[model samples]
Target chain A: MRLFRSTLTALALALPLAAPTLGLATSAHAAPYTIDNSHTSVLFKTTHLGVSPFWGRFNNVTGSFQYDAAKVDASKVQFEIDVNSVFTADKKRDDHLKSPDFFSAKQFPKITFESTSVKAGKAAGSLSVTGTLTVRGTKKTITVELAKTGEGKDPWGGERIGFEGSFVINRLDYGVSYMPEGLGKDVTIVVAVEGIKG
Target chain B: MDPILALAFGVVVPALVALAFVVVLRRPFARTARGGETDLPAPWAAGFGLAAAYGIGVGLLLGWPDLPPVDVTLVAPWAAGVAAFLGLIRDGRVRGAASGVLGLGLGVFMTGPIEDMTLRVGLIAGVTASMVALERGLARLSERLDPRGAALSQIVLVSGAALAVLFSDTASLAQATGGLAAGLGALFTLGLLWPRAAVLTRAAPAVAAILVTNLWGTTLFANGHPAVLAALTLAPLLVSFIPPLAASRRAILRIAVPAALIGIPIAAAGAFAGLRYFATEDASASEHATGPTDPTSPSAATPATPSGTPTTSGTPTTPGTSGYDPGYGY
Candidate 1:
């Protein structure tokens, strides 16, 4: 009886370690990433004064996202933008725009985008990310078409992933409808992101 | 100085001058008091005095910034003209709701693109005639109502006027004048219908006037000359004083004394700053367009003769002579 009790105690001690090993073998492979903003940019363009296209870009944007090709269902993506970092290069115009008549940056300082549903693409294929985009204290759901630009090993042996994405949004739809009707309604936003594996 | 900073100075200085006027000139202007003397609390008096001063300062700054040296020639007359119109309407000398309607009609007529003064006057006269007929019809309706009901109607009318001013793109001088006319019309209609509710009736017009005046000031600053801008700022302060001046000896002193003291300096300083800045900017732009010439260069030695004149030796070539080419010297 004493010998049988000793064997049972040893089996109980080894069970916890064995359980993790089993779990590890089947756990989804997701690479954690930090966005490299120096190499990435978010640019947008819209018609101004009804006849001319005016281009603008957000300078300070940072976010983290994770991708698991093997387990497409487990991927997640998120992004945050500093709204005050808007640069049109015209001081008077920019100041007026930042006031309550336009962006009201005092009330809403940050814009954020978070992916609720992400479908992983096959190698060199396109991925679909459905996310919630919040701007000027308003939230809207948007589905973005993201094309994977492939992954490669950096000189420092760090893994890197790149993506190119484009989306269309109406400025008036977000309460920016004070234009005099000649300006274009649709704004095109393009995103290029490069991330390093953590 | 930064334009905005100068503008701030302009706004503050005229207010101070207006306040001084009320304090120092109140006793002498006792006969001009329009509103009866029910003494206001010191704080309220001071607050309103400051507000009035600020309005005057803003007007003067908009019109002429440099006091003593550079007189505000244009804005003073504009402000005086508005004050005179308001006074005429208030004194009952103009007589009846018809005058108010006529004024509004005239204002509307002025808003048209007519460049001819004679034709514009005819249009105004025509519109005024129709407006008088309409106001007379409304007077009949007001006469049938109880005092409370009449007051309520006036409130609604005044509220409507306020709403119109707030929502409409009435940035033009004509629209501003029209808004004032509408406000005054509502006030007069209330006074005729409910004499006892005169105090309450005055509330809407006062608020509307303040708002409309400020709106005018803002728009003028955005579009008009500095002198016009200054006058727009000062107009409201002067108008607000009319009621207080007429009511009581104490009120007259309260309104007049501060206005003179505060309004003058503030308006003067702001106008000076605004004009100075504009002049500096204009001068700099002109200088930049005409680039610096090198004394040793052949272009500098060549004479720039007038359009019909023959070119002479050693005359420096004017920018205009070289097709106004920006790169000619460089």
Candidate 2:
């Protein structure tokens, strides 16, 4: 009976030590992280009249990500952006962006992204996330290079991970083609987000 | 293409194409109407030309729009097509009612999937009523006015609305509307050159449809002023009620009087739009006025998707994606 009890104690101690190894072995394993809305920003810029660069951002964005620093290839992220949340610091121009001529926010109210595949980059803590981006009811597959900013425990005892990514898309490809001359068709989208572990 | 060149391509080419179509089809269309082989009472050549021209212009500017159109802007060509088809119905009452239904559908489509039920219903109802009333008024005016007079009035009204919608801040929409005015101006010229062949009888439904749809589209979707839209809408109907002038027997007087009457409201709407535009510009001056926030401006530099080199080539390929030069690095 003593021998069996000793084995049980030994197994219990081994299990705790083996847990992290098991996690590392499973390449598909991931943890869900809710996007920290307060710390997230989705921004874009285009040229105006082919003369100067113009910038704007979406204010209301919500999404969650499945991430594992060890298994970045298995990571998946998705975002839902409220189209009406588009802001350019100018109300009239913003309104124009929301109109049918541009985003057509009324007809297609949300711009969404769902990562299809994630590949680790050559650099440490860097990844290339390939996803289908749907804007104004049109979908296009795009890849964004994401670099890990940091990961740590917050003061409130919560775990957080941050990422910054940038990608270029031709707005015309997604049918947001308005004012072809007045506004540049190619738009660069930069996304930075802090994700909280639940 | 340069912006000036592109603007010209979008405006002038479509107008010329439409004029060519009208000129080419005038003889055949007039014969068919006169023979009563076609159900339509008049040639409707200008209406058909306008619809075709607008479609071609949209194609040149935005690429041929997708089937089951993905945007409200894409719906304009289809709407113009429907208006042209409705112009074919022989019965006046049925045509007017169908125009109202078309307006209802347009309003619903323009408002899109918004959650505001009251606003949706109001837009649908307003568009329906206005289309019906405008169709009736245009039919009456078409009977009394000569072809030149009718075409002149339409050109003036549509051109004015195009300018006003431009003031409202949607350059594409204004450009599309400008194509319509250009076609009408072409039609007016055709009427002057070949009055008998370019008869505008039965063109009321199509003409009214184009006008109402564009005005409502501007007002409902593009934040255009309702009062301005209302004033423009009233202008066409008001022309129908103008009393026969003492010099109505004179050719120039006949066309000028109605065009002048239509001009009154258009001028008023334009004035209102101009004032509103300047006021907004002044109020938002701190926000950098009309243009997009310039990256090099004193304000924070916004991170943008860069398309390295600007291409005058029609294709919209970004740098790195295609062989185009990479724009500013992220």
Candidate 3:
């Protein structure tokens, strides 16, 4: 009976280890969250002709991102921006821009941005996104600054995470240097994204 | 009329004239003819007549003699005309009215200056591609309707306008013209050279126009001397003659005499202006203005705003963060 008790005790101890292994396997199947474009924004501002400041916003941004605070290394992010959906509240100018001399929407239908490396934290860790930005049949790599805004549960019981970041890109770097010299070269992009658990 | 509006009219009218020449004159004349062992004189005559009509229309509509000394708006149509001409010449037919429509559309869209490079580049590329595609598709349709003449007139009109706009100093103009030129050049230079070789004839003149207009525009923008403008204008014309020299000795003389005639005055003028601008002490106050800060440097983060709110919400807000403004926008 004592030998039987020892065997039972050993079995009980082994169960804890087995339980953790099963738990890890189950956690690995955790579903990822995707960016909710309706709830997210990518906004930016730059001086117009080096004089008055102008602000603009981009809509219809869609992407998928996987984030785990515990396993920060496993986090992944991917996104694409609709180049045609740019808005600055000026319809005439916007329409003009939608034509050639800007986006050339007919040849390059989309301007996509994809992440290369993602680092999640408040600490200053460098994050890089390498993606093809197609403009007028020309595609080029553009790297942007990225940061984790925070994650939490919405009132509806869905998990949500936010990210806010910005980066500077040269218009000429991608072969868009057609402007008077007095105009600026660098374009600053601001991103504020909110992802919901899918 | 408002100065800007008047300027726009000056640009648009000439462009329209060039368009009318392609659609009404070039297309109709080419349709009633066929290629033969002997060159077709009637169609060729009509093409020359159309060219004359375009020049006269531009001169009349722009009030050429009375136009302002520094009319920046004329740049757009001139560029578009060049593009359209190249298109018509290359395609060997008139492509519907797509080139004119695209040229005008580009002109309208490219007038604004956006501070964002990505957006700006995105905008330019998108519009140019769309216009070129539209021209090609329309040309194809026109060919289906009228095959014999459609190829010549359509290619010429589209390529001319495209080249004009792509090479123009204005962003829209340059985009349209350059996109068309590159597109047609690639199409023809590739094994697709048979029907499209005629487009090169149109391209020659378009190139000449581009070189001259660019030089003139640059000179005027800089307020340089006429001699400098003349010299800059002649350089491209002179360079174009090199390719033809290998083809025929007669072709060499044909290109050389005119090139030299135009080139001498241009070279002399450009040299004189270069000497004058560099030697003179009267630098314009506009030249003294400080330029925009380089946005590439980490230290050049946008300065904080005194309003306590970040200048750019959710992004770095620094003084000059938006870059330099030309003070044109209200």
TM-score of each prediction: 0.43, 0.81, 0.40
Q: When only chain A is evaluated, what TM-score does every model earn?
A: 0.81, 0.85, 0.74
Please say which candidate is ahead in lDDT: 1 or 2.
2
Cα lDDT of model 3 by residue, A20-67, tens digit: 567663346434888887667777666666776677766667788766
How far off is residue A77 in model 2, in Å? Answer: 1.3
**What DockQ results do all the predictions give, each relative to the true complex?**
0.01, 0.19, 0.03
* lDDT digits (tens) for residues A31-79 of candidate 1: 7788876666778788776668887666566899888777655667898
Give the winner by lDDT: 1 or 3: 1
Task: Write the number of the candidate with greater DockQ, choosing between 1 and 3.
Answer: 3
**Model 3, runs deviating above 4 Å:** A1-31, A120-143, A180-183, B1-171, B174-330
Better of 2 and 3 by DockQ: 2
- Tens-digit lDDT track of model 2 for B25-131: 64556556677443222466656777887777777776677878767656778877788878777788888888888888877776665568998888788887877
* Per-residue accuracy of model 1 over B1-330 as CA lDDT, tens digit each: 234544444433533443443244334433454345422122112223323443444343232222321111112223322322332233232333434453453434232434567865764554344333323322322333332333333333323332322222221222223323333333334334434322222122222233333333222222223343333334333333333323334533442343343344335534544554344344333323443332235433332323535333333333222212233321
Best candidate, TM-score: 2
lDDT for A75 (candidate 2):
88
Off by over 4 Å in 1: A1-28, A120-124, A180-182, B1-330
What does DockQ come to for candidate 2? 0.19
True contacts kept of 3: 0.05
Q: Which ten residues in a row have the lowest lDDT in candidate 1 chain A?
A: A91-100
